[model samples]
Target chain A: MSRKLSYREAMREAMHEALANDPRVFLMGEDVGRYGGTYAFSKGFLDEFGPERIRDTPLSELGFVGAAIGAALGGMRPIVEVMTVNFSLLALDQIVNTAAALRHMSGGQFSVPLVIRMATGAGRQLAAQHSHSLEGWYAHIPGIKVLAPATIEDARGMLAPALADPDPVVIFEHAGLFNIEGDLPDDWSADIRSARVRRQGKDVAIITHGGSLPKALAAAQTLAEQGIEAEVLDLRVLRPLDSESIAAAVAKCRRVVVVDEGWRSGSLAAEVMARIMESAFYELDAPVVRVCSEEVPIPYAKHLEDAALPQPEKIVAAVKEMMG
Target chain B: MTDHHAAAPPSGPVPWDKAFALRLLTDMLRIRRMEEKSAELYGAGKIRGFLHLYIGEEATAVGALHALAPDDNIVATYREHGHALVRGMEMGSIMAEMYGKHEGCARGHGGSMHLFDARTRLYGGNAIVGGGLPLAVGLALASKMQHEQRITACFFGDGAVAEGAFHESLNLAALWKLPVLFCCENNLYGMGTALERSESQTDLCAKAASYNMPALRADGMDIVAVHEASKQALRTLRESAGPVFVEYQTYRFRAHSMFDAELYRQKAEIEEWKTRGPIHTFTARLKAEGKLTEEEFLAIDAAANEEVAAAVAFAEAGTWEPVDDLLKDVMTPPPPAPRPGGGDAGSPPAAAPCEG
Candidate 1:
């Protein structure tokens, strides 16, 4: 049994389920209430959950995020929605310093069972200030879990396990995927741990996550038409980088291409390629290559923004180059 | 702005009965003695890192903490030895934490600036200037949502008033009508930057007033005034179910940290503030009111010394956490089986995502 839903609807369903099932759960963020969330993911949530549970916060990221951390400590499951990953920098101190370090700093005495959701990646012409893919920066932290839900099923299912986890979890919902519609299986629950192979092939492995997953999948389709078959490995969980799955994919395909929306230097693609070298160095037929965003502030013009991001054409070209 | 030089010595009666009064005094003395011992230990290389002494600010923590119920939560700043002590954290554990020992309150992970005790409902010994405010607001938010009858007390220095977190947290608490007692221990300097130099509006009460909350100022040097003001603030906070802000005007006698060279202020100013020293003035008032005898004062001082000595002994005996267990608490261990929708473990694979 399956249903069709957009990524926005899927995420809304996940949040609604969480709020309905847990009395301790609440959602607070800028425009989460009457404005219905910046992405319209929580449109009717305010009416359903009421004011106390569906809190509309002022543009105080540090305050609300820290308050969410405190609420989690006080035994409430709080999901804070920062409008975009670009603005999350305002609350970075609370998220990185306090929420991530609390349990360890408190000597295992406290764990922040908090989930922070933010829009990431760029497809629209939202300029430098609004468009950022800093999930890799968060993935670098030790005490928190970083997840990028790229598929409709993942958008619907990942929230449950993230809220259930005892530590802080950051879910980056690709801004481009919210409007994309897909089939949602009746069984939509997903693990917040492993990487899933989206498409199976033997010639080359295309490793990516979040907004780039669909591009990788589309590129694989394009590659298959030309005599080269590419495997699409969606890294659902970014932080504890499902190294096992990555290594398996690398070992199976021997040649690899990593796709990341972040800039080339110190990118998640960089980390994935390094992990492949560490775990499956001997299995490589060629050196791993990556298709990453150009090292410039994402531009406002449509063409420039597209140029700054990884596209299906770029992914296919990278795969073909690796296959050769 | 408060004129520290012109302020009169804290006088007048302590209304509480002998036992309660003595307990408050003992709490203050405990902080003073413990910190003094900690200073000596720091010199001996026993306690490393930044050692911020709460020597003169003891009255604020002791008096304000007494106004709170045992179940109420506490969030304090880096100069929080007094707050932690007054909130009932074990002196031994506090010293052990400063010593970086396994038996410390935070098991040596958090040092003096981050003494967290779950047993006492003390949220943290936060080092960031305005960091604790939002956490306190959240704690109150949780309590209000859960229908719990407890308020959270947050302590920060005057310097924190200038941070964005301070303004944002105050607005949030007031907007939500959360039950939190915003205790601002206005101890003249924030690491040698005087409050007047940092803040555009030095009147912290005005800052709170701008948030539309009832703001009060207390003589932080006077334990009685601090207690009375805090009691009034907490009372209003509980009755109204809204936040209240109290600015405890105080001073820090010691340098900002062990590394500071005491270059910012004049020695005459320190001497002037010393006359209004919380312990001496309060003891003098107790003598004038015939509430305390000289022998009783000596005994109390002796007892505090003994306690400090015992805490030092405990910290000395406390062991270092093994290097093998360094990565123990970075994350909570995952459950045996993955939690499904809404955290029900065995909810069947019906909700599991289908393989694409």
Candidate 2:
């Protein structure tokens, strides 16, 4: 039976389960072993899985990620945790050029069943270098599947399906959602396709994902208090977006607000808005609005940090404006 | 090192009867001819994109590929026309791929630098330096995990050795004891940057040895030597533990690609290497050994020319993929599902995050 757990605990449980079930599955990253995860997601895994499986690597992202890709190619299920999205830039080539493109390039003869998990999004006031969301960049690639596990259930269940998938899958764990706790159903399984409706409303639809899901939901609650019911959609799979669900929500609500943690320009939110315009424009009663993070480097100061990101107030304001 | 003698008696000198040798010669000649035609085609603006000719590199691919079994996997770089031809991919399909026809090996999706034939287990004609190494490692890993008696041979130029992927792949192959043959073709130049200028340690075997894997070097210009060395190395890899690295000291007589201006090295250096060209040197050796005659060489050459003519015709007649299916194969379409959230319009489910 599934029980209530925090996003951190759910992710830890998934890793623990994978290590216990598969002899080939292992964890490797900068602090995935003795130091637990950098976010303490795998706090007690080192003692459970031992150093061999729960390996701690040097501060060489390219070396270790390439090694992980190698290890995956070599018959092991390597879950490489690249401490933060900012640092994953060092290993970008291996992920983009090698891991993702190998399968189709091989004429479907080879598949890299590798899973890479990295912390993304900004809410902790960690300055410019640390606070960027680049999951959309990965989603732009063709061969790999990109997943953002926004909830506890997704954190617990996504790893299994990801490991089972025959292609490389990149999982982005929002830095802001680790402590958020929720009830897990007795039979819970999170599919890596389609969007999950977080809140039901008919007046306006609030579409978002990753770290922004919580803020969107909070704004939906605030909107509910003001008697403006907002439908909240959590986009779990970023690459092959569940456009049907999104289109359905837009058709019903007729007004939409996209809440994205990424910058406004060339954002995933932009893609969603474009899709809406292309498919559901005639059904829309008002123009779709977007509440994206300010088009600037996420600042370190508390006030500036709040100002840089999409907040519940911003979502509330966007939804109210859309309702009008 | 103790010589682990062959378990089987050399497959009777590798079945290199007159017919087989002629076939080998014909195969190498076909690659040479097709590439020559491709160069002409590139000049005429019929074949666009980077066209890396496998002119002088033919014998290395023909020799080394002949040593491998059909079940074994092959991963090669952009300059892989020879490897693709010798690995049993249909000549017509590869030619069609070069022409970017829909009937090509990769169905026109991948061009000259990305020829792929899954039926022959030719993984790719990868353009990215060192990109195919990790893929080869993974294929070998799958074979090992599945308890299949298969090896993956990855071919890249010396330039790929300088890539981090090369070192990482070497270490993983050694650590996991995967059956991989890392074939490095040291053609001396990574597109105008000579190996001496790019690499700090010129001895590539020394670098591979750092991973505790056995490494060998061969005269790539000599087809017999390459064949013998690769056969021995494959035997060692198959019978023993872990991966092996083979450095084939080769030279490319043609420009790096069709676009090269031929300004990188001196004309004298080119003439010097051409003296040891694989075809001329091997044909001379075979004639000296009385294994082949001048008339037999001509017969093989005529047969290769005939095959190339037929392949060109086949490519010319190939079809293009319909524009309607341009977005196919991006993702496997998902199965139909019942609409979630109580078939739509059910009160927005209380801002709940997805459950595990």
Candidate 3:
């Protein structure tokens, strides 16, 4: 039997593998060292990698991320971790302005080979401040590549390629999916580009990424029994949008439903739908629908939070509505 | 401490030899002439965007940069035309960048505010208030991890002391014992806001020392002081495990930019600072010591003018980048495609562009 690993363990394994393989690759972030990471991702890494390799940073996201970019320029492959996507706003200027613009601004003289990993999405009753689906905002940027690793394979495989990439790459690890365990084949490597068809169907396409991917899968299963075959397309790479795969899914299914944790207003789902409209409009059987979190700030209560997020039932409803 | 501003006129015999003295003098002159022409170009609409001139602040860059090796990394602020020139960046590329030309450094994508060159290790001409501090920390971290003896010199205005990045970077660098030279160019103002008005505690050295860092203050107007202070910091960085902070007490002669109407300060104050102008006083001391004659000074000035003219002509001839190639280099040429059907699904291609 293939060994099963949780999404969090897959990420930790990938980081550990990168560190053990490449001397240049070091992990730096708040609480990543002695504290064992805010989410316990870097547990026992400090002793293995030592204090130098496993750096614990102060609550200075802007400083550390910028330093990570500089280190990348100075010829070290750095993997920077921000506690969550909500706190990443503090370092957005460095990510967008410095990391993204450095290579082109330097006229190809420099490339920031830096990887930034941050937990994202709303679940576990973390409330508004701790949880936010800001991956959509990051995906809007052009210079940096954005990744949403939903599956255990993706969580395990994406880090190596991201660290291997010359340009700055931001990986969004949905907080909700961290504990979800799945089977991982021995060879668990993947590319940082293109969407993957987790479940193939011709009747409808359930397009989504990150925390919403599981919900999308469950919804697909529900739609399968109802005689509506829905293809579950995981948008692995969000920035470039894996337009080819998105178009392929839309063309095959002819009906589309975008499930995202972000709100409907100008979300990544909106951008995906717009691309589908532009490229696969003629093939569409019905208007593309979106099942997104409510526009209000996510409340702490479980029922309110669940009601606000994209549930499996919600994805099923959106897919059914799109098919109709 | 009365602002020494070229105190006591060089004592007796000249300190630096003729060749070395002339090189330092010529560097300041080059910055002065380039920026003077840049101001004219700005008026002619040849160079747009914010042009922060380093007219009087030449000594700080000229002296400090000369103290470091060619391979050392430099992270500077927007008013960095002088730093770029002193670090051996071509004047033509700097001028061409201001012109937004394809042949320019950074290929004209970043205007006056953003100047970068990978070959020279000039990290950037960072414009954000305290943006370069964190970058310098990172560069030093890389050098430390690789066991390389290179130092990362970060230059920023006193305005940066107010930023959280400055505090965090200082703490990080100090705690980690990374090799970094924190060059604080205390030019008295942060785009119209004076130091005392903005900062609660204006003593920069004390702030750096609070982080358990060894700090010093240098006369930013005096080339010798700036150079010596930088060398001291460099030695500390090379020998010691921690970072050093040096506050360059300097002033700017021109308005912050072409847009300023000189609203904040008085003309007399500007004139008083001009009395302490780095170029003329250093030239005066050189003349008194006979290391520089009137003819030699004029010749140096004339040479600077000629270089500025040549740079302007070069910028005039530079071309614009085609809009089609705009997307190139955003990512590292997307690594060459994985070969046929042989490689493992999880394995990366051999042509990985990172860690080079």
Q: Highest lDDT: give the candidate number.
A: 1
Error of 3 at B288 (Å): 0.6
Q: What TM-score number comes out for model 1?
A: 0.96
* Poorest lDDT segment (10 consecutive residues) of candidate 1 chain A: A315-324
Kindly provide the TM-score of model 3 when superposed on the true structure, using C-alpha atoms: 0.96
TM agreement with the true structure for every prediction: 0.96, 0.87, 0.96
Deviation in Å, model 3, residue A33 alpha carbon: 1.9
DockQ-based ranking: 3, 1, 2
Q: Local error of candidate 2 at A149, Å? A: 1.7
Estimate the Cα RMSD of every predicted model relative to the unseen true structure.
4.0, 6.0, 2.6
Q: What DockQ does every candidate get?
A: 0.50, 0.24, 0.56
Winning model by DockQ: 3
Interface RMSD of each: 8.2, 10.0, 3.2
Better of 1 and 3 by lDDT: 1
Q: What is the lDDT of residue B266 in candidate 2?
A: 95
Question: What lDDT tens digits, residue by residue, belong to model 3 across residues A12-65?
Answer: 998999889888889999999999998899999999999889999989999899
